[model samples]
Target: MSKRKKSTTAFKKANKFIPGGVNSPARAFSAVEMDPIFIEKGEGAYLYDIDGNQYLEYVNSWGPMILGYNPPQVIEELEKQLQLGTSFGAPTEVETEIAELITEFYPAVDKVRMVNSGTEATMSAIRLARGYTGRDKIVKLEGCYHGHGDSLLVDAGSGLATLGIKGSPGVTENTARETIVAPYNDQKAVAEIFNKYGSEIAGIILEPVTGNMGVIAPQRGYLEFLREITYKNGSLLIFDEVMTGFRLSRGGAQELYAIEPDLSTFGKIIGGGMPVGAYAGKKEIMDYVAPLGPVYQAGTLSGNPMAMQAGLTTLKALKKEDVYLELEKKGQKLEAGIKKNIEELNFPAYFNRVGSMFTLFFTDKEVQNYQDVKECDLDLFAAYFKEMINQGIYLPPSQFEANFISLALTDSDLDKTITANYKALNKLKAEL
Candidate 1:
């Protein structure tokens, strides 16, 4: 371990050019009450910071590095494509190949369109939905972050919650009006909205299992209710599976829950860590996009070959092994260990988990929605985050984000983390 003098100096210089010294708000570390640590490299389960400190990385680049940083399979395929070309601004075989793989896994995704990011995916999906349904409004839930797409940011979680911003400026009042926000996990509220605006709603979009609001799972029968009501109302059901896709299961949240959505948006693991996103749906609906139909969208780097190669390689590797089971076992181990610590220490914390994603909330109550998540003691979470960093462990810098568990984590890594967590809880308890 070493001091973060170099990181401090780098962030100071970065602040001169980049806004808040980070490319993304989540990386700003504002919520954690500290300057961000710049990573020199990530190999296997560890991240090495510029200051020469090693951390057992838990963020996993916010859920994309499921195979851990620099997995040989992905890098090898990327190297093969690197020699061929980067981007052609034209069609490539790898793009079709990756899309085909996704289609085979998800019955809801008979066709898909590649895009630059999750924001683009959700944005395009919304446009397509409106065009297809001939409707003017969209429904989104509280705390389910689709992306920075203007229509989807009204009550977003993650960065907005971390920064305490209600919604971004520059978004038109008309755009906000077009979006109807509802409380998550409350089927009654969703049904009431549908009962009133059913005919006007183009679609209802939400994360089937949210990571943005720190890994809140859908209540039993919740997904089915959305699927049924949307169908009955002639409205599209859109699953914002950007974070849960491929990470939760081979077929994503839809397969895990056995519910089919009219449209599904994906990112993160699908790109194998490269910048990529996609929106897909049944052939009848996806045909509404672009050249096939009226709703237009375009991107030069939409299906970059390198990203396709990386995504294909990663997805193929997942198919060859019991990756999901392995991840689940690791997740279960970590959860049990932490829960045991909480019970013994009598800590006032609530833990929520779904597969490899989890959050240790600072609130004592069960966190079912954003209102409950707000009850969390942010100041205590900040102190715990800093303590974990001091102990050579890295976590998501905000209580609003979920921490990842990767396949690269060894038993020793889990052991160390458990011990570190126990010590952190006990130490924080003493200080109280």
Candidate 2:
């Protein structure tokens, strides 16, 4: 096994200062029942832990590094901007440039506001929606995590699910009541909620293609159903594309699915692996945000030069004709290889993939929603995760999280991963 002595020590040291030894709960590896690895550095598709062991990374920094870590072009642009300055807390031309690029790709967005993280984008978007619609309550899909904002913490997925918390303790019951929860992919449940509280609901927010609950794709006609219901109820439809933006396609799931939401939130690949996010929509509705209308959302570092430059560089790179095609090719190869291993081993597992994002759920039945995902054999997944890590393949620690593929991975890397997967499956079989 690769030595993790340094990582273990670092975790101990971090715990003295940082809560649970992680800035984010997802990084704690709590779901896998292990200490988090301290990454020393990442190059291309590989991560070198503090102990010097190298891993073929599938986490891709939780779905940002789509072109892989520190791509030369993005780094060069960021360096040029860093020499200029980091944060200005004022307007910069680059912000407008990136915004233009975003609006161009996502035609549904005629205007956008940048933020420091996905949470801010989603939170701000909801506020804008309520302001525009002049309504109070909002409907959110269960297990489709938007962020940790008080109104969104109810029945969330991701770290909350990983740590076995139903909902946060501090979130007020009143806030929870304002935020209606419904199962993902269950249009009937959404419709029923709308029927009961149509006028009260400000909007409905969901991950167009869910990544929080192991990359569940919306069922056929589900998006259309949501669009119709929201329109009929005179409520806006919000697509939280924090995980799917740019990574799934140049225009994200909205483009691939050809569904236009009233508002959309973006992060991950948009920042080029930096801390950045955005909320955007039709010009008429976005006008409801601060300065233009009454809703107030402001961040000093919302449009930092470095982040804007990095995002612009990444978006330009992705705009290349063959980028998404290449990603789709790589995704297919990886999926086919894993499917082959599952067939050969007769493993009771379900693999779900959408473009370069995927998940391997340790269950025999198809996973259509969070409830289905919960039925997965998490113990088996924990064991499988351990074996994969032992073989120098790094995956997302939580069974409920999705794995991302990057352009940095090579055919050779895919082969090694397939080999490791086979070996891991055999080991699991042997142990059982």
lDDT tens digits by residue: candidate 1, 1-432 = 578999999999999999999999999999988999999999999999998899998999898999999999899988888898998999998899999999998988899899989999999999999999999899999998989989888989999999999999999999999999999999999989988988899999999998898989999999999999999999999999889999889999999999999999999998999999999999999898879988899998999998988888888888966789999999999999999999999999999999999999998899999999988999999989988999999999999998999999998999999999999989899987
Residues 71-143, candidate 2: write the lDDT tens digits: 9999999889888888888899999999999999998999999999999999999999888989999999999
Model 1 clashes, total count:
0
Q: Give one clash count per candidate, in the order shown.
A: 0, 0
Candidate no. 1 TM-score = 0.99
Supply the global lDDT for candidate 1.
0.93
How close is every model to the real structure, measured as TM-score? 0.99, 0.99
lDDT of each candidate versus the true structure: 0.93, 0.93
By summed lDDT, the worst window of 10 consecutive residues in model 1 runs over 314-323
